[model samples]
Target: MPSPLPADLTPTELVELMQRLTLEEQAELDHLLTAGLPRWLPQVGPQTDALESEADIVFYGGQAGGGKSDLLLGAALTRHEHSIIFRRESVQLVGLEERVARILGSRSGYNGQAKVWRLPGATPRILEFGSVKEPNDWMKYQGRAHDLKGFDEITHFLETQFRTLIGWMRTDNPSVRQRVICAGNPPTDAEGEWVIRYWAPWLDPQHPNPAQPGELRWFVTDEEGGDREVPGPEPVMVGGELMTPKSRTFIRSSVDDNLFLQLTGYKATLQALPEPLRSQMLRGNFMAGRSDPVWQLIPTDWVKAAMTRWSPRQEKGPMTALGLDPSRGGADKTSAARRHGAWFDVLVTAPGQVTCDGPTAAGFVAPLVRNGACICVDSIGIGSSALDFIKGLNLLVLAVAGSEASTGSTVAGNLRFRNKRAEMYWRLREALDPAAEPPIALPPDQELLGDLCAVRYKVAQLGKAAAIQIRDKDEIRELLGRSPDKGDSVALTFVSGIPMPGPARQRTAREVPDWRVC
Candidate 1:
């Protein structure tokens, strides 16, 4: 529900209303009152902008130790006269309550039972501390109303909970501007994927479609499609009358932006995290995780840095290759990944030609292979047909029989990979390693990143030799509710015999032989 503030209300009225606001509200309103401005540090200037603007929702977060918690608290304080701040666990509020108490000092009266600190008056100003630990806890707030609502460590809550609470951000006082503010650290798993998706365009510093800091974008909820965002508030006919679009703004700030934290060793601590975690926490990367805990591959930071250096050029010496993973079921995806130098970001998937066998599919594949786009196909299920068909054509294609024995990269001792699939995937990891030059860049693909993260490898003994066996896509699909088709497609690109970068003249796709269709 929107605040009761009239569109035509004068600026003077808004100021007069804020003057009598509770201490919490005063903290934030002070800037507005003093100079009709939102005071802020350069580090958190955008945060202030979002809070002061008419934007209904604002997400101020990114890298850890960005003073996100403090900002959230301050924002809550500014609106505390009619405010409610949330923490995931009710217990977490105790520490925050202490901070609130120190700020309120002797001017406030607490009522723990009511979860509120009150400044008694004919029109009393109050600030409340609360929690919504579990999704169901939201039910307790069904009838509550407040102009200001906040969520700290928002990634810890469920999407449904956040949605439900938004419905409660209503107030009779237009002077008490209604705002939803949230803060959190970088997410670590697929569970955080929802938050990432909601804020992706702004969260990704490299996003092609950048949402400027403090700019608002609107989204509408649909019964069929859920919530879909719009570039700006689109006018909607509500009972023959136009309605304003509700908007959201996400402000991204890293530890480096917060001078206080940067002055401490916190930034160094975040940098010390391993691989993807370091990137996720330090860079405030939303797409960093989305992998299963047990199966994460290709450190996220390594991938992020490599993406900056990704050049879609075939190396001068090695041949660029395409990996194909045709869908098994008729409607399943047939994903294809293009390996340019050592990168796996270029991926494409197409459906398999049903009833085709390895020997016959080779006829169609020969033309593509002859054209210099070397092919690597998954030889499992219907793919075996394409594999056999292409092999008979005498084309330079890798028909990967995943279950086949591992043949490359001998172990330090008796350790070995379980099958060809393991060897291929392990090599893909090595290719993504930062030490490998001409860095690999993946497509800005959330699905592919998730797939890569979902692949879990386990070591088991086979006849006195230890071998690593990667989890199958079927297993991964259970975790992600979809096949890792894109991931497998890239993995296929690494099959032995595929061309790799070397010292030679660079070859463009145009240089290959013309395709001879089957």
Candidate 2:
């Protein structure tokens, strides 16, 4: 009698056993097992490229109707041993779930309550669908591990939530592969702009070093938690420790890439949309929706022009001023900007975990403050603590309180501001104006650019006249999804005229003046 087949034979074990069988027997057994298996494979173009990409992180979609959702689902089903795909909300999973049911020919392996599909085999594969709706909702999956993680419509989620959930991507199974795949269209709003910065080498027109589509680049986090791109994929020494950089790439796909979508008349639908939306959806233009808001305090084009004029080799005057925006313990960061005449240096930031207290914040500022540089510090809330420490050291410091009354007007002298913050920000705006003498040169920094462009202004009635009032910090935070630390620091640079520090003078608590435009 023939030996009985093993009940717990894994796919790998079965493949090994098949090698010992006769050619006819092997063919017969292969036909018996796979004859009626439901088929789902990646489509021919960008979808296949995405599936074959060996990048640690891959961003796959640019335009709508590109079969992005199906790409995520098919990758999980066909290749991964354990996978989870996320949408911003649970309701978005309905269509995906239905498609999954059709592919399997039945819902027998699906556990709707747990939102997982357990494929039957000796080593069962697991596919899960989840949502992270709120900012803190990512904590729900804190410790759960998966070999492959997918984010659909990634721009709809906060960057923090995306980073936190991807921290759990891991696998112990030797047969499984590890990767993160994100699919989304270009961001439609200011809040989603982080995605552009995250993939700047591919998306940002002003990126110093641009990369072609599907080109691989490597990046590692610096000591301050900011990403720094390296030369190649090799491990490098950082902060005295060896670290390996993660490889990332972007693959652009549009409606044209999906023949099925093209035949369904999706191209015309995208073209019928409004101005910016139509351009964004049809051409996959990352630069769409970049027009400044009507009340935007600063124009986007002005900032871009300033960045273009800036070069590391440009001659700069002595460091004249320093601006500090300190943060209390939490997700916030303590940021500083140093100004030399019309040129500003790249921002320096320390996470709240490192610079939470007064002394710690002071420590970060002290070494950066030169002998003649006038230091401007935000004196509201936790910033006041840092200001106190700096003042104690006998440094020339200007304590900035945004809520205080404005002591200055626009450079043209015709416009008035509601408060010091408005006045300070307006000064930077005036300096950046194309017609202004001594044009400002700003370092190419994406977060600083976003912060400067995100704020809006309105005319507020002040007794007999109208004054320009900027929106509250809390409101801007809601729109940008984080505090405008970099913007605040840059604005603070203009709190007072660049003073020529004559001599070291003994100072009292009251000697530290409130923000006053010299």
Candidate 3:
């Protein structure tokens, strides 16, 4: 027989029902019995909503510590029996594995897991863990059946990895449809591009959330190279009571979101290191400036002029050194700069030097070589392109080898990358300090200026004594809200200890017109 409909109780009825019950009964009614009911979930603001179609793929993207992962995990538990969770890195999966195991075993932890659980009178075995760091690792679950598949930190994994895993989740639950759930923060320097292309449209700020009523449409590609459009369904409010397909479901939760975030004060201690580290970790941001930024204390007006359209002209001097941030043809930028003793002239060469989006760094060095400058390009990753490019240039293209960069001018392989960056930071700090009286003027580039502003310094303690240490590269990336690669390249120029060159051709008073008089 069909279960009897729940009595439609009004606010008065609810109060009376609670008033008549005993303490134990009232507690049960308030929390255990009525909590999952749609009426009790609180209509304060937009609540947990679900996407339409069990077959559809859902993506939840934003800052860290948002209720995103928590919601995904809760939804996955609904299909307990055939739920598989995929994490990009083994380290992240290990954290999830430990949490799940703890819940299943008898423990002292709160019983929140059981309070929300409901099934067909059976404590069904639901949920499994898997990873895709290496494609072959997915082989272990060949015959696995899952109604729900969750990809945590989806941005970290490649698109191909996600597609391959979804194909494996063949579910048996007739009631529960097969679907994929993804949760992650925004893209970083290391993130791949396809995500920004497909998923970005749906979550990008430009698109109205909940998609302007009927205007909202979700599309899926089918077997035949054709596309079909589907209407976005109101989200299934998990407890079977409330159903909302409202577009206001997206919520931002940062380190401030997690109540448990306080447990990790180590991240907070990082603020003492430098401005770059403090900004990156404390507030989830990225920067191109590392401990030693390329453009330290550069004037604001200089950077503004560059952005406005400063023509790139060969400096009228002997270029002493060159700065290069090689690109791998992958979103990163390739940059080169010629340092004349008194001023530095930088060229983007390709549009992609500030963001990883253009020709490889090695591919952009011909100009510097022709100028007979000492080139210091990043030798990290596919930096070999820089090496090959420089060698082919037959000029003085040297590698900035330390741990990153492929250029040949690396330190004696003795110092770690962090240490080398620290050394550079020390030198930069010295130069920028008013007491040191640095002579060079700041360049006119936004990217360089922003890195300088975001940099910070802190003191480190060793037992009874304390010494100051510059922030690390990762910290710099976080503070700037972009990759600090260009800043690092600039920093390398300072560390190289090569003197800035003077003008190759002398300009007589006749050639140098005093514009002030005109």
lDDT at 281 for candidate 1? 80
How much does candidate 1 score in TM-score? 0.50
Per-residue lDDT tens digits of candidate 3, residues 1-518?
53543578543444544566688876664576555452212111111333332335666544454445655666654444567777866567656655544433432332334312222225363555666675345556566667777878776665546655776656566665667777665544322333434443354333333342113355544321122333455444332344333221223335443323333443356456465445544553433123433433333333433334334455546666677766533334455665655456664434342223212344445434434566766666656555664555444555655443222121333322234455554445444443443345445544555554455544455344443345665565544334555566666666544533233322233432221211
Return the TM-score for each candidate structure: 0.50, 0.81, 0.41
Q: Could you tell me the TM-score of candidate 3?
A: 0.41
Q: Which 10 successive residues of model 1 have the least lDDT summed?
A: 509-518
Tell me the tens digit of each residue's lDDT in model 2 across 358-474: 767777777676656878999898788888878776777888898888857777676688998898898999999999899999988878888898889998887677788998788
Who wins the lDDT comparison? 2
- Runs of candidate 3 exceeding 4 Å displacement: 1-22, 25-45, 50-70, 79-81, 85-125, 129-249, 252-322, 325-361, 367-374, 378-399, 403-421, 428-487, 499-518
- In order, the Cα lDDT scores of the candidates are 0.66, 0.83, 0.48
Residue lDDT tens for model 1, 228-265: 56557777654345656688878776776554454455
lDDT of 1 at 196: 66
Candidate 2 yields a Cα-based lDDT of 0.83
Superposed Cα deviation of residue 288, candidate 1 (Å): 12
Off by over 4 Å in 1: 1-58, 62-182, 188-201, 208-210, 217-248, 252-296, 313-320, 327-334, 340-345, 349-374, 379-405, 410-414, 435-447, 474-482, 497-518
In angstroms, give how far residue 416 of model 3 lies from its true place.
Answer: 15
